[model samples]
Target: MSSSAAGRPDDPVAALAELTEAQRQQAMRRWRLLRPHLEDGVAITRLAAATDASPRTLHRWLTAYRNDGLAGLARRPRADKGRRHFPADLRLLIEGLALREPRASIATVARQAAAVARDQGWPIPSYATVYDIVRRIDPAMATLALDGEKRYRDVFDLVHRRQAERPNQIWQADHTQLDLWVITPAGRPARPWLTVIQDDHSRAIAGYAVNLGAPTALTTALTLRQAIWRKSDPGWHVCGIPEIFHVDHGSDFTSLHLEQVMADLRIRPVFSLPGRPRGRGKVERIFGTVNQMCLSQLPGYAPRGTRDRAGRAQLTLAELDTAIGTFIRTIYNHSPHGETGVPPQQRWESASFIPRMPDSLEQLDLLLLTIAKPRKIHPDGIHFQGLRYLDPILAAYVGDSVVIRYDPRDMAEIRIFHTGHFLCRAICPDLANHTISLKDITAARNARRRDLRAQLRDRASVVDRLIEAHQVPDPMPLPPPAAPAEAPPVRRLKRYREE
Candidate 1:
C-alpha cells in the first residue's frame, strides 16, 4: 500500500454526474456569471446589475466557489426545508385529518382546523401550511390510512423480483387477450388470447399458443407442452423443464392437471399471491413489447378503445399466428433485451448447458396434454362429447374405466390410458377425415341448441295462438258429463305367505 498505489480522492468538480439537471444548470449559470470577474477582473457591482442578482449574493457565491470548488456553486437546499413549527397535538391532528378516509382537500382541512384552533385558543394553520404538512406525510402511511393496506403494499412494499441463475432454472407463463382482432373460421371477427412461456434468465420465449378463445387449463397445458419439447425452429434453442414455474393465480395456472404435470416433471410451481401481479412483471413486460412492436404493424390492430375494430379485421387467425411466430423468431429473439443487454437467444445459449428433456415426445404429451377425462368404454366404443371414438383395442377394454388425453387443436383422435399405461389412440369415425377443434365442437353444439330453443318457442307461440282463437270460455261446464260407469271389483289373491 504505497502512496502511488493508493486511489486518489474524487474531485468534486469532475463528479458532475452526481448532480441533478437543475443543480447542474444552476452551477453552470453561477460559474458563467462569475467567470467574467474571475478571469478578466470585472467588478461585482457591474456584474450584479447585468445579471439582476445583487452584489452581496455574487460575493457569497464567489467565496463558496473558492472554498468548496464547483459543487458549492449550486443552489443550496434549506436546512429546515421540511420541518414545521407547530405544536405536537396540532401536527398530529392535521395529519390525522389528511389520512382520514374520504380524504379532505387542503382548503377544507385548513378551514376545519382553523375553526378548531379558534375554539381551543391555538394558532391557525394557513392553506399553504396545511398543504405542506399533507405533502410531507409519508406516502406509504397516507395510502395505508386512506386507500387501504393492499394499495400500500402494491405501491410501497419491496418486491423480491425472481432471478434465475441459469437458462433452464426458472420459467414464467401468462395469458393475455391480444389487442388485435382477427377473422375466425366462421368468417366472424374475434379477439384471440395468447399464452406464452419464457425462460426467466434469458428473457427468451420458449413457446406460445394463439387461439380465438379464452385461455383455459388446456391452453396452458398445450403451451407448456410446446415449451418443454425441443422446437423445430433452429433459432429457438430454449427447451427443457424448469426448476421453478412462476405464474399468477389464474385458474388455468392453478389447475389440478397442471399441478400434477409439474409434480411429475419435478418442476416447482410458484404462484404469485392473489391480486399481486408484481411477481409476474418479467413475463407481463413481454406482452406489451409484442403489442407495440409486432401487432401494431398488422391489420386489425385494435388496441383498447378502437372504434369498429371488428370491421377492420382482415387477417385470419392462422395468418396472425404465423405473423406472431415470425416476429418472435426474427425480431424479438434476435433483438438485444434492455435488461439483459444481449439477444435472448444468445444469452440462452451462452451458458452452454444441456437442457433437461423428457425421455420422448410421447411421454411429454402424456404429462402435458390439456385435459384427462375418465371414460368407460361402451359396447360400441368410447363416447365423449357426443362423439363416439373407436379402436380395435377398445373392444377388450369395454366396461372398464380409462383416462383419455387429446389435443384440443385436433379432436379426431385421442390417446387412451388404462391403469396408468398407454393403451391406444382411438379415432372418431365422424371426425377422422377432417380436423375439428374442441372449440368448434362446443360452438356448433351451442348454435344447434340455440336454434332448437328458438324453434320450440316459435311453435309453442303458434299453438297458444291457435288454442286462444278456438276457445269458448263459457262452455267449460260440460266436462262434468264425461264420468264413466263403475265395474265390479275382483277377489283379492294373496301372492305371498307369512313364511
Candidate 2:
C-alpha cells in the first residue's frame, strides 16, 4: 500500500502512520507480499525484479505468511531485546541512589552503580543506560520513597467527585480558618475559624459557627445541631438529618461524642480517607465563596497577612457571628448557584417529606453537647466546673448521679439527664438568666475582690479620721440637756397634783 493510503484518517491503516520508520518498513514489506495474492495472478519473477529481491527470499516470505499470516511477515525481534548488558541489580541500586536524601548527581549515581557492579564482578552499564533507568522512575513512587506518603498524596493523589441523589440525602461538614480577622473578647485582632455544613445536592449552607477558638468537636457538633434542627429563620429551611454526613478524617470528626450523635440520629457518617479529600469539594467551594463574597467586604478582612486591611478589626466575636449568619440567610441561600441553576433554599425546600428530627431541642442538645458528665445531685443542686446548679426536679434525684449537658459558652443553666433520659434544666442561683462564661466568672471574682479591697480601705480611712478627731476634741456642754429635762418634770408634777 502507498504511504498516503496508509495515513487515511478513518482507515485501520492510519495506525501504521504512527509507527517508527523501521516498523513502517516491515508493514510495507508485508503489504507488498500480500497484495499480489489478492490481485490477479502475477508473476513472482516480475514481483521479485520490481522489489529488487531474490526469488528464494520471496519464496521464504510467502511460506512464512502462509504459516503465521501478517505476524509471520513482520520483522522478528532480536533475541536479546530486553536483556541488560550490565548487572541486573544495578538499575535497582541506581533508582535507590536517585531517591536518597540530599540527592546526588547523575554522574555520582553512575559512579556508585559502577562501584557496586565492580564489587559484584558484573558488567557496568553505560552513562546513557543508567540515566534512562533513573529518569523512568514513576514520580509518585519516587516521591514516596524520598519524602513520605503525605507529600506524594498531596502532589499526585486523585480527588473524588460525588453527586448526591437528592437534597438532604447527603451533606458535607468541614472547618476552615477564614482569611478574616475579628476582634476577640480580649479586644485583639485575631483570625477566626468557621465550621460549616452544606447540603451536597443543592449546595445550600445548612449551618455554620464563627468562633475565635480553633476548630474542635464541640464546634463541629454545634454546627451540626443548627443544621439538623429547625431554624428560627423561616428563610433558611434546610434543616434535616442527612442520610449521609460527609466529613474529613479529622480528630474532631472522629470524636466519640460526634459519633454517638450520628448514631442516635441514624445519620451515616462517611469520612473521607485521611490525607485524601476527594469527597469534600462542595464544602470547600462554599468556604471559598464565604472568603470571596462575604468576608472580603468586611472591615477586618485578612486575606494574606495578619493586618492586611487598613482599618482595625471593629466587630467582636458575637458581632462577626451575627454578620455571617445574616449573610448565609439573606445572601447565600437566596442567590442563584452556578451549578444548581436555582437558589439553594428553593431547591432544598422543593421536596415535601418531613425530616427526621429529635423529639425536641432538649433531646437534640443531649445528643450533640460534648460536655456531659455524671455529677451527683447534692441537696443544694449539681455542682459543675466550680458552679452550683439547681432545679426543682433535682430535688427528686438528690444524691443520685445524673448526667448534665451544657454549652461551654453559657454556664447559667445545664440540661439534666437521668439514666439517659432528659429531666429538666438546672440553674445556678448566682448566674440565673445570665450568660456567664468561665472567663466572665473569673473576671467577676477579680472585680469583687477589688471592690472589697476598696471598701476596706475606705473603712480604714474613716476609722483613722475618727481617731484623729477624737484625739483632741472639745467636750460638748452638758447643761443644755439638764435644762430641757427640768422643764418637762415641772409640768408633769403639776398635772399629777391635779389628778
Q: Backbone clashes per model, in order? A: 0, 1
How high is the CA lDDT of each candidate model?
0.85, 0.79
Error of 2 at 117 (Å): 14
Q: Model 2, 5-94: lDDT tens per residue?
A: 322234344444456678667956765765774354566787778787777877777666555444455666699985567656777888
Give the TM-score of each candidate. Answer: 0.71, 0.60
Name the regions of candidate 1 deviating beyond 4 angstroms.
1-79, 186-188, 305-308, 367-371, 434-499
How much does candidate 1 score in TM-score?
0.71
Q: Which stretches of candidate 2 lie over 4 Å from their true place?
A: 1-99, 103-142, 145-147, 158-160, 304-311, 336-342, 351-353, 392-397, 418-422, 433-499
**Residue pairs with backbone atoms closer than 3 Å in model 2 (clashes):** 160-278
State residue 23's C-alpha deviation in candidate 1, in Å: 8.5
Local lDDT at 91 for model 1? 78
lDDT of 1 by residue, 63-133 (tens): 77776567778887899987767677787888888888798888888888888888888888898888888
